[model samples]
Target: MACSIMVTAKQFFGDPITCITDEIPQKVMDTYCWIQSTFTLPHQLDRVAGEEVAHDGVGSYVDGQHEKKYHKYYQWVVFMLFFQAMCFYVPHYLWKIWESNRVRNLVSDLNNPILEDEKKTKQLKSLTMYLKDNFRFHKWYAARFFICEMLNFVNVVVQIWLVDRFLDYEFSNYGTEVLSFTEMDSEYRTDPMTRIFPKVTKCIFHKYGASGSIQTFDSLCILPLNIINEKIYIILWFWYMFLAVVTGFSIIYRCILCSSPQFRLQTLRMRNRIVDFHILESVFNHGDIGDWFLFLLLARNIDQLTYRQLIEQLDVSITKKTDRESFTISMDNERESKDEVGMLKIEKVDDFKKF
Candidate 1:
């Protein structure tokens, strides 16, 4: 994920962004770019992020020492299941609200071809047109939504079961290790504190890998736990992939809906402004794409990761162009000031001064 994001940032920023830490596997990058280009974001629109202005530095150190340590959430799995159940109720409520809104607008204007002078009437017309064009789209949307909800419910159950089993097995093995220590010669025990040492050592090895006093122990003792962890990891991969597919689909759907020229223009304008602000902020902050990338990488590494982490990682890359950033910010601010004073204004190309 980190490598993919770095590639994206490099494309967007129009400069080199290194993977000094190699936090992301090369195979993962290959799969990510292939899947993203094949099934999700096309290369054409992907160019937009590359053209945007970047923050001050393209690559820098990522500090994560202050970040919270990853913790398992065996209990939160129940809430995930509950949340999926609640989603079943949401669509119906949303349908009622949408129907009422539509009805209210229709009642206010009986004429089929309403006057364009009324803003509310124009909105109703737009809504009608949008619905007419998208009704078929809605059916597929609802079907996908329901399928995802049901899958989430099933996943929550499976995740909770698997995680709990893994934890129990881990602790059971630790208990065996502790018991074995007692069997060894008392002289070899070294100290009373060493009794608690094995568990702490185990966790440290899991995170940092034979570093700084918590070196690897006998492989025979850890082989079973390592095998169990690997199985748990395989299940986690599919879960992560499912989440990524769903999120990528959602981004695609949104792009589809916003493909209209007006919407794209507005989105482009808005994106430009955000990049500008970040770059100005970056001049003083000196933070680079790595800060954002690292945050996302850590988030992805957590036990129950979400696609939003990946999205955010890509967002930094996609929005890395500095020129677009400055232009957008300036244009938006200009438009905002004009709107604030109740005077209609459209900016001319000459209004922007070259830096």
Candidate 2:
């Protein structure tokens, strides 16, 4: 937002374009050229200034003979910057809605170390119970958050490409060309900034003569705005590339960490040394992918000591629950075995009577 505001202030409040003309009123010519847009002669930029073209990108628009590269998006630069800024928040917004406050409910105010002991213990127990009961139900919840992260990576990539398109495919090489320009001999070098964003261009205004014949007026226009534009884009080009690389790598690492349980276990241990390794492994083994993901999130949000206690409590609760289930299944099997023995004895007695 700040970036957009700055660009907007300089581009609009300042005179974006100035035209030299005696035939047309100065203000009228400036506004007309700015609104209608201006074009540069691409072929003339390479020619020697004094011997060929009078100035860089300066020459005749004779019968529209020269290949023209119109300065199209200078007027829309701020709006584009604003759009880019807004796109970055889209994933965050989706996650906010998708999250549904599940994390908040689980984390509660437990992270606050100054809480009353009784209230804190009560909340901790409640959190443990919730995790114990809700196991295996939150796969989509954790997965959805990761999907939003993937969207964030995608957003970065899209904005990079969008800027390239906005600059007529010049943005991809803008930074590189600028950096390498000094290596070339001065006689052979052309400024990439000027090529992508020209300070001077031409605009044609048409009118009718007193005799009613069509008359054409050509004007040489100066754009001081491109100075600001070149600097802004060079900074942005490097920023976007760096951001893209980091975000992309982060997404790949997350995908690998989530896919491999060993990596997840190692990460948990690395983050929380107080938690028992055996407990972590036991709970992690029994739980599905989503459970570990949510647990990891809780570890980040909750206070360290509290999180250790919470993990211990969860381990105890799961252990008891599993033991009860095992006992019930064993008792049922024993009862079935006794019933089978009784049925066999009854059948023996009936066979003995028949004999």
Candidate 3:
């Protein structure tokens, strides 16, 4: 969308104004020809021929010719802008597909509160078992996630290269240039022309077959569009660089988190502390953390051997609590019976025992 907006602005408002005149006076052409004649020697025909060849080889010494080349690739620049934006979004689309198929279904089953306690426990146990048995799937998912992040980094790098290649100068160096804050003076740093776009340029046009002679016309023009392109690319260059840096860190963090045993241990300790694990189903169902949780689930599966140990510990804690409750209930029942019997006996046996 941003790319589209920039392209539109360039087409309508960024076009350069061309210089116009009623006609080139005959006196001006006569004077130009006289000046040209003075710079040449008709007697030295070979020398003049060699000089013309050299001049052509050196390519358009006039400023107008040089500026003409700048506008030639404007179409290519706009095409790349839209292409780069689409490339950056590819990873996100892949993640969405994975989330919809696998993560959402699992979270839904786990979070269904209407299910009987035994069925819910069975479901959790089955999920844990599945995770333990399918360790390879976890590793594969982690690798896929890492690849997606690296793709983002690659997209940014490619975009930076494209900008430099097309602009062919320090114009695309805004990312690095912005770092040297202390070295740059205020006027150059703040100059709109320097940062916004290239405005003033010379353009040359040829009038052909005019009285069987070619005439060259040069004029100064303003390319308002180059300014818009400059500003858009400068911001895009830095934004992509920052995104790549963040993605690199996230990949590292995910690798470490998934590979370590600590994460599983932490999950085990925190599992029972959750009052409503079902509420977290919605969180895993959507949002940024959903992908992370999917990876975590896969990681747990990979270490099923160790994860089963945590499950055993959980089972032991549940059994101990159930036993304690049952013993307390039995003691309470026995005490109540004893009190009722003693009251019905009228205390005759208590007096005999004291004697």
Candidate 4:
């Protein structure tokens, strides 16, 4: 933002040096030059040469300064860049909120060992149902994430249009000409004055109200500010292009990760290993692949685990009922053996007494 504002400031302060004139009277020239330097006007004049030139207000100079028009627009562009950055962050914030409110509580309940078996079983069933519902919410969150990237791409393209609109057709075509693969040569790249930003241009100045006649002057003027504008836009053009490519790739990668079942399964397996190995949470916490997406994938895996546990519990209950009579008979046989051993010991004692 400061860089952008600095470019505009250079243009504003340097507008006076944009035009130069010869052959005009020193008094008239000084007055005109003062006006140009002192005030921001709707139009400006270029250098002119003639034997006798009429004196008019400085407003009768060359074309209006393009930089004046561009300053406000550039500021707005910088502001929008900040706004888009914030937009990208909003989804992450919302995901954190959802995790705190919904996910943490479920995990705490499921991990508690002191709960009755029946209660734990019920909680598992409930957690599975809850996760299925949250999966739909994850889809929505993922959509928002992709939308942010799309907006970033759109912003870059819009900024390009804004550059063209304010800077004119010559600057608008700069990207195509400069970035063209075949057009770049050593001469074109090295010559900043002529190739990057042209400084020389024809300027017209009109002098009014001297002897009720208007005097016009035309000459070549050197625009120093064009150099600054040219350099700024060139860098911006490349920056926007880089931004567009990265955002495009991000969108594509995210789509592939979400849509492919195999990828989701692979992520789930990796997540399980992470949990089992007691890995650092930071490994998954601070990456482009967001924590919320990982959480959703893990939720699906937990749902599967819940179903498996329920099935095993049902199998235990059914088998226990069928084996009840066998278990009772084994217990009775052990008791009978103990009683017989005790009765033999008592008989030995009675025989000794009779002897």
**TM-scores of the models, in the order given:** 0.20, 0.91, 0.55, 0.46
Model 2 alpha-carbon drift over 4 Å, by segment: 10-13, 48-54, 335-355
Best by TM-score: 2
Q: Once superposed on the true structure, which residue ranges of model 1 sit more than 4 Å away at CA?
A: 1-117, 132-137, 168-355
Residue-level lDDT tens digits of model 1 in 1-355:
2322322343344321111113445444333322321111111111222243111111122234322122132223334334534644564565554434433443343232443556544544454344333323433333344445454545544544554354433332343354466787763442211221111111111123445553321110111122223333344445545654675576565445334433433343343333343332332132233232222222333212122322233344334544577899999999999786654323333354331
Worst 10 residues of 3 by lDDT: 37-46
Model 4 Cα lDDT, one tens digit per residue, 1-355: 5444554475464642344567676455534533442222222322121322221112333444342211223224445445544554565575565445554566545555566778877876665455433333455555555666566667666666755665444445576676563566643232322333444444445777659798877544444555665666677667777776887787787678866655744564464543331222322221234434645544554544543453344334434543785788888998999999999999999999999
- What's the CA error at residue 268 for candidate 1, in Å? 35
Q: In model 2, what lDDT does residue 113 have?
A: 76
lDDT of 2 by residue, 1-355 (tens): 7767886675354777899999999999999988988988888888787788766887865665768888878889989889988899899999999988888887888988799999999999999899899888888988898898899889988888999999999999899999999899888888899898898888999999999999889999998878888998999999989988998999999889877989988888887888889988888877888988888889899877998899899999999999999999999999999999999999999999999
- How does candidate 1 score on lDDT? 0.35
- The number of clashing residue pairs in each candidate reads 14, 0, 3, 7
lDDT of 3: 0.52
Count of clashing pairs, candidate 4: 7
Provide the lowest-lDDT 10-residue window in model 4: 48-57
For model 3, residues 1-355, the per-residue Cα lDDT tens digits are 5765667663566442333223555444334322321111112222222355321112234443332234344446667777776877898888766545565454435445465767766766665445334423454565666677777777677767776676655546565665674477753343333332434433445566748798766543444566666667667777877876887787687666556645533453354433233433322222233233453564344334333433453344445655788999999999999999988686777777887
Query: Is 2 or 4 the stronger prediction by TM-score?
Result: 2
Model 3 reaches what TM-score against the true structure? 0.55
Alpha carbon lDDT of residue 102, candidate 3?
A: 67
Q: What is the model-wide C-alpha lDDT for candidate 4?
A: 0.50
Off by over 4 Å in 3: 9-73, 97-100, 109-136, 169-172, 176-196, 263-355
lDDT of 3 at 327: 100
